[model samples]
Target: MAGSVSPRFARWLAFAGWALVGAGYAFGVLSLMSIGVFVLAGSVVLTLLVRRAWGRGGIAGLVSGLGLPVLYVAYLNRGGPGWVCTTSGPAMSCTDAWNPWPWLAVGVAFVAGGIALQLRRPAAAG
Candidate 1:
């Protein structure tokens, strides 16, 4: 079975996928839910579509797929130049918007890693 993904990696991937799904729903971030679904579904689709030859490249493909939506959502929520305001009985305060740069950086890194993984050849089997 050349290029078959290991069972261990598959199990870990499944666990990560479910965790993402749970976290997304728990945190009320629907975009995360979407990404989780994509990961899970992509795994299955790749498994069937690529069969034995999917290998690490398939994992990389999923990582790439996972990144796109994250980038999109992060971009949308990147926040504008303004103060987030709050008030209480003759008192008022304001703060800057939640920064999306961290998320964007992470997304970019993951995307780059995925692409790099795909470009690199798999290690030789023992």
Candidate 2:
């Protein structure tokens, strides 16, 4: 399967993962942004690891790019909050939105994905 995947595809996946993270951050969803950054960074590391092991990098990128969104949605469903400017803002209570599970989940996912990619077997040579 590794031999069947193209390096270019992997690079694109990595690029997409980073792009999602940047977009999430730019939107001011701090938790999501943090998740994105973590995932993006992990994707980069995975790319490097894969490159070194298989003479290419990107499987992690692809997995991350596809997985982050799913995880993000899951986190949201589990009560992820929207960005709030201040505790004083109407309809924005810090206590209600301050749950740490989302962040933890994202971090764990990023780390797990990175570790998995790093440990994966090298792609078979053509």
lDDT of each: 0.51, 0.49
What local lDDT does model 2 show for residue 106? 71
Which ranges in model 2 have alpha carbons more than 4 Å from their true place? 1-57, 66-95, 123-126
Lowest lDDT block of 10, candidate 2 = 19-28
lDDT of 1 by residue, 34-72 (tens): 565565555455445443443333345445555655666
Model 2, 1-126: lDDT tens digits are 255767655555444554344333333344454565665565566546545553433344443444455455556545535443445545655423445466557756764675466446364321
In the order shown, what is each candidate's alpha-carbon RMSD? Answer: 10.6, 11.0
User: After aligning candidate 1 to the native by TM-score, how far in Å is the CA of 124 from where it should be?
Assistant: 11
lDDT of 1: 0.51
Report residue 71 deviation for candidate 1 (angstroms): 0.6
Report how far residue 122 has shifted in candidate 2, in Å: 0.8
The alpha-carbon lDDT assigned to residue 54 of candidate 1 equals 35
Give candidate 1 regions above 4 Å deviation: 1-58, 80-97, 122-126
